[model samples]
Target: MLYNNITELIGNTPILRISPEVHKLKNIELYAKLEFYNPFGSVKDRIAYGMIKEDLKDIKENGKTIIESSSGNTAKALQILAHINGITFKTVTNRIKIPEVKNILRILGTDIEELPGLSECPDPTDPNDPIRFIENMVSQEPHKYYHTAQYSNMKNRDTHYKTTGREIYEDIGTVDYFLGTLGTTGSSRGIIEYLTEKNPHLVKVGIIADKGDTIPGIRNVDEMHEVGIYEKTLYDDIITVNSLEAINGMETLIRQSGVLGGPTSGGAFWGTLKYLEEVDKSLSEKKTAVFVVCDRVEPYISYIQKRRPDFFEVETHKDTIRNLSNEELANVNTISIGEALEWVEENNPLIIDLRGNMAFRTSHIPNSINITDNYFEELIDAGIPFSNNILVMLVCPVGEKSNKFVALMKKKGFDAYSLEGGIVSWRDAGYPMKPLNLKKKEQAVI
Candidate 1:
């Protein structure tokens, strides 16, 4: 088990059988290929080490700083790889909300440049956007930086082909289906290529995030791209899993099977369930499928909280025992994020962030107090700061749960109003959601 460096510990991640209740329906056997067991805690550890180890000459000569645009995991893996190799690394990314990923990149001394605002897909016209930003940097400073651009990098997919794909075949000889989330298309491309080579009939389900959804480590439908060795024609099925389903899948994995994986893994699992449910019933019977566990779950706690703390009551009000009508629900106190912004300007509003701790830390209205989930219980535990003069505003990813909570808070004699449209709308309206830790607002907004 001894190794010269952590890079040596990159591949050979363990795969475990997943027999959760939610996945029990169609006589299909699901297994999770746990890439988080890798040293840097994600599958990207494979590609990061693979690319850098291949380019020691380039790194030693001209790679003053290893640079790339990333959603998070690959940049993190590259940061670790760069640290060991005595090279600096920089990241060009959008507003990455995951606290764990951000902290690691920050602690590693990564020169991160964050793009302001959210755009579902990369706009070709915008020079300061995600995929384009990296291109601009590499084009501008080819001598000063070496870009490990995962999207278009052949080595990115090739590494997975050589190691990740080969490992699965060597471990479990007959994998009926290979399910993977589409990120840089490295993992899926590699696995699909190798697996299909062995069994031409192997079902390749490419998982993608649903439209208007932002699941980290994987691209949504709007952001889809075919870069590097990515062959779109190879996929037997392309499944679009949305954000709520992803959260449910992640929670199921953690609670039922003890598989703590990131949102991409959630999307992969969601894809598997969808494939079984909607795809041909003939393939559903006694099928063996392997899904990629892309990364560990620590990076997405905040997102998890926004969904609901262990309660998928987003179908909503089930636990209320007394259902509130649509008119009653509509009557709950509310304020626009703009109005809330104005209130905050003149006076202090006790902004009770109902999103998880990490999400609050990632971005929240200034001077807001975060309350944990199990809503009423956590509120009681923290003790109410309610008073007649005090303005209390509740926040969540969207306004649904906040509106529900406002109903409960009003009955509790607290003057609480849900911030209409939640934080997403606030950001959508071009209001600034401060990137908490990073000091440079202009240079690096993450």
Candidate 2:
């Protein structure tokens, strides 16, 4: 695989067949398109290279540096493309992105800028907010930089249409459904647009994070954080999955396929499986579903190694509870600040603050125990009991992590609930906090 330019490595990813038993769907063929083989080790390589070339063509007429904002994979792809093209590149991302991605970006000589106050933003919407900030910077300093606004860039889709989409269509011959995670919607949308032209009945499914009104593994209308403006018009259908479902599915994929993809890949796989189940029940004819294995397992190695090492070796199917709707999960057992106080007075329930120790030390629910991530597993291992008959509340800085932790506790055979809006909401609702005080003695000025 000798290539003179990064752009030359844009398309032609390998397709592999996997056992249907692992996916838990009967009488259906499954295939995975390994997009990680791209130059940047993800499908975003095509988009990054395409957007840069098009933006450069429109702006510089000759040659110029590139600047963009990306969370992980896109930034790495852009770095590779820029390095090959002899263009200086700068990437702005938040601090909480997977550490391996930051290291790769640094290795590629990208001028990295970390956004402030981004740790609390759990979703991709806020994580991608740096795009606007970078746009502002490029507007003021236009001479030396070009911004590849991936969220809104048509080139992202164009590259996929020109390369990945065509390659899949040519290789598979007939793809009943195109499944992939919905980040910018470039990969799915591009393939849909290209393939639909040939096969009008082809289905395009976009997988989104479960937030509002959306099903756990199917589509609905919600403010998708990673879905860009282009996606609304691009996707034929959308599917949403909660964090737990995504995590569990990721574990399942690693166990079955010996491929450890990230959360987004798991979401896509789950969406495809659910779709196949529905199709199997409805149609008699055999169906073939294709999903994009969007990225490699390397960037996520550390995360899975630390949080779910058991999944690294075993491929056991875990049953996920999907009876509770997102709305039910959002509001179930949630209490307002006043209501929480009143409930605590009446029930005397144990409130476990899920926020990290630092935030818990700053201030927390009155008399709540600080069981941070560091000590959470330890405490659970120590046989800390939660009375099933009594109310148990989990609290965090914001609601997302608390919700996830509550789900984990529930899965671990505990009747637990999470405080909606967490500590921020409690303070916003006029709750008082007991600030920690350090022991200090009067001393002479030194």
> Whole-model Cα lDDT per candidate?
0.72, 0.66
Q: Estimate each model's TM-score.
A: 0.69, 0.71
1-446: candidate 1 lDDT, tens digit per residue: 57886767889898888764657756667788999999888998888877778776678676578888875778888887787777888888864766677887887778788775443322222234566767776789778888877888888878888988888888877788888888789889988788888888898888888653568877776567535556789898788987778877887888888998877787788778888665436653576778888888887776666555545344432333024456667789998777767766776767776655445556666656556434443444355545745667877666766787677666656787887887777767777665455453321111
The runs of at least 3 residues in candidate 1 whose Cα sits more than 4 Å from the true structure, single-residue gaps closed, are 20-22, 119-127, 226-229, 278-280, 283-285, 310-446
* Cα error, candidate 1, residue 280 (Å): 7.5
How many backbone clashes are present in model 2? 4
The prediction achieving the highest lDDT against the true structure is: 1
Residue pairs clashing in model 1 are 313-316
Model 2 residue 416 CA deviation in Å: 12
Number of the top candidate by TM-score?
2
